[model samples]
Target: MSDKMKKGQGPADEEQNAQWVASRSLMNVGSLDESGYLNSFYRQGYNLSKCLSESFANAKDAGADKIVFEDTESYNRIIDNGRGMSRDDFKSMFSFQKPNHSDRKSCGISGIGGKIAQCILSNKKTSTTYTFNGDEYLVANAPWDRMFEYGVFSDMITIDNMNQYQIDMFNARTNGNTGTIIEFPRNDDVIDVIKQNFSRNNKDDKQSKMECVYNPCDMINVVFGGFRLDISYKRRDGEVEQMQMYDYFGEESEKYYDGKTTRTIEHYYDARKDISRYILKADDVQDESDMEIPRVGRGYSKDPRKVSAPYEGYIKKGEYVAVVGQRHYTDMDEEPPETIIQCYDDRKKCFYDEQFEEGISDHRAPLYRNGQMIGKFHCSDVKYTNSRANSKSYHEIKSVQLKLSYSTHCTQDNLLDKCMGIQQNKNQFQSEDMPVNLTRLLGYIKKDKATMIYKYFESIRTQPISPSQPSEVEQPVSPSQPVELRQSVEDSMTQRSVNGYVTGPLTPIQVTIALGINIGDLTLETLTRLGKDRHIIAMFNAVNK
Candidate 1:
């Protein structure tokens, strides 16, 4: 540092400077622009309803037992009686890098979930008042107007800045000093943008209750249907509406079954796996006279909306529904398996009954992390052709139209580990176990002869009723009405009918094709042995009759 060390420079300083320059030369340093990042995130399939979900998730994490949503003509407010934050935590809410929660059972893992809501919905000037443990009240103001101007939300204020009037209002709304209130002015531009992205019709018509809360399905769809907290919405008209777990939202034109009965079955927790399974069973008696295959109806078109009832599909006499859920207790130590398989039904969309809509999707089961729904899970990675209602996989899942529901929770106190990787914005999560879970669920239906699913399939296989009530006496098929029996190997086999029944050896493929039995693991010899089964023979004969 002779020329460079004219001042107070040492050999150690020169060596350190050389290393720094060498390191800088070898690597290209890059940084993320907050404004550009946010703009790009919004453009890439980011659902605006997620803003509402993120807020609800934060409220739930704070152990809020009640949440109130109020939408007025000029502003929208959310009030919650949760354990509000301290001054330091309140200020951090506006920071781009928010702190991650320590509760493993939390619905939010990404630290930015709460901040996203504040950033995306903070129009003009936003004020948030909160009190922790019945202590002094504090308020923070976010001047979002300066967000893009400076490409940062740094110019925000957080302190015990609430006036007497603001404190009184907060106490009035929350009924307690330990609570939080977030209020923002109504921005029609943001609302219209959300509507244009999510609405099926995308028309700028008058807002309905379904379209009121940013048009993400409805208020009910904003959160998990089975959310434990008491949620109430104060309408713009001043009418307060309470939301129940299983409120039916069907239209008048849609069909409703009055004969459905529901029962909950709590499964024993596995000590080794630390998982508990719960079943919500919905059963209905089928009327043979009304036996009609489920078909896609109107209201699904692009132009004129003629909404049809969801799940107008056939109802078996006594079959179980399907819905799946899970909760995490401890952190995940190991990486998920690399192989991921999913199932799909691309033909038409399937909506669930209100009782089982903890989550909903077109076809795949809703995938939930902790209590929050992140995405959907399929049976296989590749799309399975469901055009044939008689396909083994499709019929097994669709015949009963079962809404399979199960949940898992952790009792310990580890927050760093997680069973799933919930991606940013929460559109998806790492679901490596989904395929295995779905396959096991289907196996439970087939392997357990004691299950109603087994009994229902057995009923269909053994008896061939011709639009008549089932009877003990097996009557001959009516010659006037001949039902064609289809085969899986239609090209390789011939169809023959004798004595109102098909008399032939039932191959494994034929059994799977005709009776929807999975024969992947069974050998030809194993299937030949099953052909001797009177029930298998009866199933084959019943189909032709």
Candidate 2:
């Protein structure tokens, strides 16, 4: 026997000695209430996909390149090519209610992901976890039923030398390298729940089942690069079907033509205020179209007159521009629904926009923190609904989707901080402060620019064109027509003089008509002095009319 094995040997054998030491250490060091800790997770809410996502996140944190999920006749296994756990790590994993690992940037900040998953999977049954390190291995056997019966966590858990079957399973999955393998008795209910939860169709209806079949490959695609998850299952015909991470989800293709238009606003950290502020503004861009129309002056007048000035057709660009597209959920024959104006805040990862349908409240955006969606906000002025599939009252906007996103630093804004303070279940934020902040922020958005752009395109689509006259139609004019045409031109000029305002710089004829004098009587100095005087210009325009 090797020196290490010989040294570990006791009365019965090395294997028996290892088991005793493991059990003793667990009892001596593990000081936590397993049942209470697990109950807390249940109270918080247990999502099957979230549990699995936590496991995958852990694997990524460990720098694992490959992960596998296999269903055997007796057990279901999840194996990963991650750095195997040390003795301390193995113990710490089960030490419930612990904080997150300080070094890892993991989403499982509570450090209960693996424990919750394992306990739920075992469900009072026996489960095994093996961790391999070089030539040595550690095994943890969890007999949950026995532990619950004894009311002591250490009584049900045993740390021992790995058995041959476990060694074989580990070798086959990790190619005999250092890694971790978890196994539990095959439970169809758990497997079905996982399949249903991770399915893409559950994006909108997370709580209930839909007609779509579960595709593990697509699920992997949705959460790609974080970790690799593969599933191996047997078909009814006795053939094994294996699925690996694919490059695209089913909805990705649909987004190609009907994706949301996005604009990003970056803010640098400010040291003075100890917060970052992103100022949202839209820039004006000249329209490229060659078509020209008359430019109308602002406000109303009883006698409106067109000047020599033409419309420049300048349009607002940058963040001020809003996306105008057909509704994603309309049929071909049906008229396209109204444009939806969506605003997404990237920092908070929340959206604020008008609701599609009428409900009790006008809330339409879902709030999120640390990637997990919490709840909705219903401030009177700026209400938002939870975006989760389980929300009982979801609001939809039929027309004008306006999406906007705020930076993470903006959450620290006084108004937002107060609103977020009263959040429940991280799900809903209720405070008058929310509406106050939202109203202030939205004031910067130029809705008139979006409306002008929408109208410009709408006119092109609806305007009717008159047919051209045929070449065979001959035209002739009498001599008297030329004299009448000149008389009409003079009459039109006289009418314009009656209605036009003499403001700013004016031509000789304009000044002559405005002052009711001949052109020869007007001097450059006189015209400049009269143009600058609002009272004189107004009186001259009124007298001419």
Candidate 3:
């Protein structure tokens, strides 16, 4: 071959060349032994359930509520899938100090050992995961396991008799095919997530559960692939319906779940367009075609995230929440994943600080209190970017800007308009055809209001009373003192007395004024034009003067 041809890459040479280039990094330093790889899972902190709940919460907010919410049978299996650390995936999902997982590949990798993504909810609430994996593989990282066992995964002891989802999954994956079964025995603490966000179904059974607890590999897919996912909670009775879908790792999902299957991008975008209604519409997105869901195939086609939450912002509009700061690179590194949460703050008249977060492993879409973060943005999976960690060459950081808008309960930026609990203008106050969106807005509000209403009456029940109870019809007091006992009578007397003082139309206040000219010469019509609050006050003061 000529020198020009030799210098350029051939298909075969490029493959070897790419590996050589990848090997230059520290990722190629040394591979981990099998035992060392298993030790990584031991480092995952307690409160795995809390992390699972946040994943569900975030997924629900972005309109995936329907596809993921589950019952105990399906939820547990998904949890197993997320917590799973097979010999194939990373040696440790949370930490970067893996012996087997090297920086040879250009994929994102982290070595600093911390699990902000999986352990955040522990500070917020207690967590529990119920699965049918015979508890043998039902790994748990609870409080007692931690104080005594250190930062190791405390495996649960179990009998195979209680396994329901496992049996179902085994049936589905009979022979060579492989499938998973997960169940959620209880209502997740993050029910507000779906209540505030998305839904897939109301009362459907028999269909297999669609969500997993979100293990680190899944985290890799979600963080590196831009995958919108969530952890689901399913139960036996129809109590926990299949209303929402996917466990979100907040913004850095599409980077991780960008799996390569026998799927065409053109077909994927086409199907996304056809099912645009099933997909979601956001305001920030202008060219809907430009919004490409990188990976597709097998799942998500039968069920996808629901467009059930209201769009962000009051009708006035302007402030927007868009995803920015991409940490995923095609090259290898030992850096952690991080991103920015950009939103306009009208009061500050500018954007919030250039914030760097560990990144969300789940969606709690900018948790709001009267529409603001109570303390600080909960950053998950955060690590600083570095070009030096793996000693690889040609490292670059690019901020991927996305036209952002939510596809649930509302829409903006050319996406589809979502359905809120309120009826549309056409339907006009009729809830008949109107679908009740997720419970985030009015549901949570109504629940709080209902609690308050109940407590008010309950307080009345607990109040002190006379030992003798009055009969329903019998008089409790004599006619004279009865007036005090008759609440309605006292109210009527007061209203009647006020009515005597003010019965007719509001009486116009009579005032004599010297408008610097003369009130005597001024006509009512002339006075109307000059009537300002200040002028009126001046006229009244002048009259008094």
Candidate 4:
């Protein structure tokens, strides 16, 4: 053949050579430095619990009923009896922020939860994944450190066999079951970083840390944040030992629940088009008094002329029902000053109380979407201005802690589906899409329920003396007595002094003065007799000038 003809080569040979070059280039792309993308996109709130929760969620999604968290001398392992990933799934695991499966019922919607967990918890460049697929056990070694350093997804290695060490551990722990084991080499740095980020300095942070505890044996009655977490493991000698993880809240004060109220709200609204709707079923058991569940469609109406008319545009517009019950803990003697409202999804994933800061103007009743708490809302349907004191939204959320359970049925075709504004984290409802009319209805329900609760407690407080006991008589105060004596007698009858300071019973004039206004017309005695109601306090401040 001529020299030119030989150099040109056969068409088949040229195509093969080009294909090889393209394959090499794809490999190079896999190995490129991904640190920028990882840092910018994947570095979410890096807490140990978040990492562990994600791991648990992954296990649960994979159909794992039993999970074991073991810390060994060489590495930390999260072993689960879930169906192990296939080769394709194993490779797809490294894809950033992209989930292979989108199951609405699962806690891990974004597939990056595990990746984020692993990146934040592992110090080394590699993590070992061992999965069994019936006939053979497969091992995939992910070079995550190298991926972060070189910025490529191609450094991972997979094989059909495990090293002697892995085999031994698998035999000892899983007894050769078909499952998945994720191993991260012991890294104190990762642990330290997690602790630093999750330090319990605030109420929300403390609550978040508490929400991470999981018990594999009892999935239904899992406690969120608590004083103790029991972990069971086999000792070197083969005896099983149970250990506890303690001091989860550090220095934060622990809350005790004396009463609980479980409420179920089921509502649906159709405004020509399906405007907004919900079907809620909750069991509240946290209050000392009996709950008076309002009539669903008809009882909420206020018009005397239309007594039978459904509470206009409220629960009447749709098919709604709620069953509420309250119970006080018999062990507790006195009511707790502050009530605790804990919100959980159907999956038992706890929504942190902090999520309520947004959208919930007063944080009275936390909002829920498909069982996960989106946020909290004011008890009343009023908005407030800084100078106006009370535009109706100002109420202490802690006064009545309630577990509001409901589910949203917003399909792809529903208007609510178009407006359902859930955040990527699934922790909050976007305020822009929050249905005001629905919220107002809920607020009305909670407010009325809370009023009844207060009234019940007030009745208890003002119970008349038993007929068996002799009633005490009060002598009238003489006007001739010294001003201080007369004032002191009246104060003793209405208010009590704790230490040297008078506690309450502030009069309108006193409220005005307390609100930084000089009430020139009223006497100090009259001002001192006013009750410390929030509305009165607000009115005092508003009209003080």
Candidate 5:
């Protein structure tokens, strides 16, 4: 054999006499569809909220430590005291091909987020002023909306193109020379959305005014690298009101129990897997009075038991925490059928659910991705099983905020892939594996550790009031009921229960058939108000025997 062959390079490598032939196939290059290109930006789930979120992300990426949001009848503005953009940097915002920020801490995945936000808000009429060193301030106006309307995307900007109005607005809003100010023409819809989502009743106000819900100093250790955010809005009476930025993490964390005490689970990283996990579990359960009083703003609710339930979970994967807790299966019974809020007006609905409620507390911890709130953290592995009928040892995890944090050469590519999984607008996650891994992380607790953690939380609950000692949960399945019939009944009950039908009174077996759906679905009011028919009564009687 040839030396090259012996070395695993193959005999072909030694064929110096061989002449290589090159072949090519010709294909037509298609023309760009300008309309479709413009439409693609809108399709990415950008609404007023997401646009604002992108603005904040841009500021954060620029190393901004302080951000201010201003809303008035004339215009809306976002001013950030960060390392402001240079002229080239400002120009890049208009480029379709400009790459997203490569910084690991940056939320700029698509270079076009800021541009798209501008076009969506002001169309072609957008104004921005930026300075790199607080020395020479430059203001530029881009016709982004017009570019979309004409299907002619342009990145060219003149450094001296500021008009008198733009100059005045820029000077009025800009403070330090080393900062950026983004302004778009007044958008009433945007203003209204800000008020709706960010406002909360202030108990201290004699006139019962709603204040902004943000707490700037809260959760500084984690989110946005601890940036300070301030917000102001012009009231209808021409008075300016300063509102606090909504503090999703801090408020949601404390409210896990009594809105007073929270248990912080230290960070956990699996070096073997190159993944990091963090959790904030509720240390104590709510007392009776705590459950009945509804505070204002997010996480404020009367009957938190009905709102969040005993052991429910919530996941947040976007800019803000959801206003309502997980829809209580128990409260549905007492709630009048007519009172159930649906998206009556189709126009009011966006890609995300927007039904606002009084409270932020939920049975589960809100989920976050890279510090932004997303969705709920759920695990099928932590559930009760018929095989372990006598054991109540399943992890009673109150709420968890799961995120991905990894810093390693081998895992950098994996993190890149995870970043790509985020949708263009960054509203929610589309990655299938991302969630599966997070779910596995939830089960990372060792059997002993799980027991220890549960006992610790139980001790906290016992401090305020005596909780009933847990006895072995009786097996819910009845030996008399045919296994096949019971399975069929379980399936039927599950489907019916989901559609809001009351399950017949089948007792332990029914409970065993569906743990979450059965207890959550069946309420005293539902039992009396709905399932009184003879068919249900007969089934109920049949199952008990």
Candidate 6:
């Protein structure tokens, strides 16, 4: 791959591929088909693919990994090593805002998952999958009828001899030594667009150009050396900032891209914690860090992994943190810390675009990879997203005006619950230092630390995405629209209900229930009014249990 990229093209040749020249404007401005459908599904797929790849992109370290965006019009994605779930995880991946997922850690947030991807792509879910280790597996959204001779499935699918490089890669990746692959076929025009839009531009400063036009939000994609935690200024606004650790971190860091000079900073004793982070406005940065805080942006988490429920020992943690980016990255196989805290999306207010609630809060944290989504931190993420740069979304959702807020502090953000909304008390975590055991709670007190921790996390509903990102999450507005699209999807980016979580692919019904709703009644005012207007318990409730 590296040889292909390097030997393939240089500046002048790269310039020939218009895809590199066109900025972020291309994201939102896609070609529409005669059917009025958005024909630029390639960009949509690329956008989603980027997020998926990012989860494993950094190679799980602060240095040594290399993420090189290539010029090839057609590229492939590989998903390997997830032994048991190779197939289930593939099926539920879709384009819906905060769609519920099988792996909920990196992606499971309220409003930042597959659903958001769907919204970007005109509410569509166009994908194909194959599972073969000799035994037949399910398949979806492919043009198998035209190409394959035969295939088989139990319930919903089958296609045979469905040869595609994409599927081959997926298969190879899945089987570890072997796996299945699924690729969406691109339209002829899209092929040109992909080529023209995403060229092999090894321009002068890959740093300067490793940006998505307008969505300057992409800027943070380059901030991995040491992320900027700008929440301090606003955090001091109320009494809130005092106990919060979202503004905490390590010192001595640098930000670099594949082909650009590096940016460095010394945050050896920074107050912010490692997990949750924030940005600094120019003035704020100058005042505090003695440096000009570049224009930063927030990325909502859009991972589509579902959270597993609270089993005794299955505690899991995920972080979509861009340990690597356009410049400096980790080696291909470094393992990040296995803490259960997820590294993407908001915990309190999952996937809520600040615009709906009105701007300027620490909600969206600008995430990076030479400032690219690497597919992890979008204010939203899922099946697909726009590539048109100059679209009205910027003004519609101004940068300075909106933000995504989260917390590593745990206890801070979910103010209503006072538990682990942001969960700052590291003491609560099961560690050797505490010298305390959860056995007393179940057996000691006397449960086990696992149960104790589960209850603890559940009580506060630790949000997955950090509060360091600018955020403004409030209750849903009672808009006159027909019962707003029920939150059918789980945000691979939203925070989970502290203790329990959904582990595998969820049915639409399961997702709806997890979101606490019944899709059948979305349009019914009677159901809406009933929830809005609750009746007294009347003391008659004591009978059943």
Off by over 4 Å in 6: 1-104, 110-126, 131-138, 142-180, 187-201, 205-214, 218-545
> Any idea what lDDT model 3 has?
0.27
- What root-mean-square deviation over C-alphas does model 1 reach? 17.8
Error of 1 at 455 (Å): 2.7
Q: What is the lDDT of residue 6 in candidate 4?
A: 59
Question: Which residue runs does candidate 3 get wrong by more than 4 Å?
Answer: 1-50, 53-69, 73-85, 88-91, 94-233, 238-545
Ranking, TM-score, top scorer first: 1, 5, 4, 2, 6, 3
Could you tell which candidate, 1 or 5, scores higher by TM-score? 1
Task: Return the lDDT, model 2, position 530.
Answer: 30
TM-score (C-alpha, index-matched) for candidate 1? 0.53
Candidate 2's residue-wise lDDT over 163-219, tens digit each?
798688678778999888888888777566545533432245534336223432123
Query: Which candidate, 1 or 4, would have the higher TM-score against the true structure?
Result: 1
| Shift in Å, residue 353, candidate 3 | 25
> Which stretches of candidate 5 lie above 4 Å from their native place?
1-31, 123-133, 155-168, 201-227, 234-370, 374-377, 380-420, 431-435, 444-453, 457-545
Top of the candidates by TM-score? 1
Best by lDDT: 1
Q: Lowest summed lDDT over 10 consecutive residues: which window, candidate 1?
A: 336-345
- Per-residue lDDT of model 6, residues 88-112, tens digit only: 4444433223233223222132222
Q: Each candidate: what lDDT? A: 0.45, 0.43, 0.27, 0.44, 0.44, 0.25
Candidate 4 accuracy as lDDT: 0.44
Give the C-alpha miss distance for residue 471 in model 5, angstroms: 32
User: Higher-TM-score candidate among 3 and 4?
Assistant: 4
Query: Candidate 4's residue-wise lDDT over 13-85, tens digit each?
Result: 5777567567656454454345565664344544554566556556765667666666566777778787777
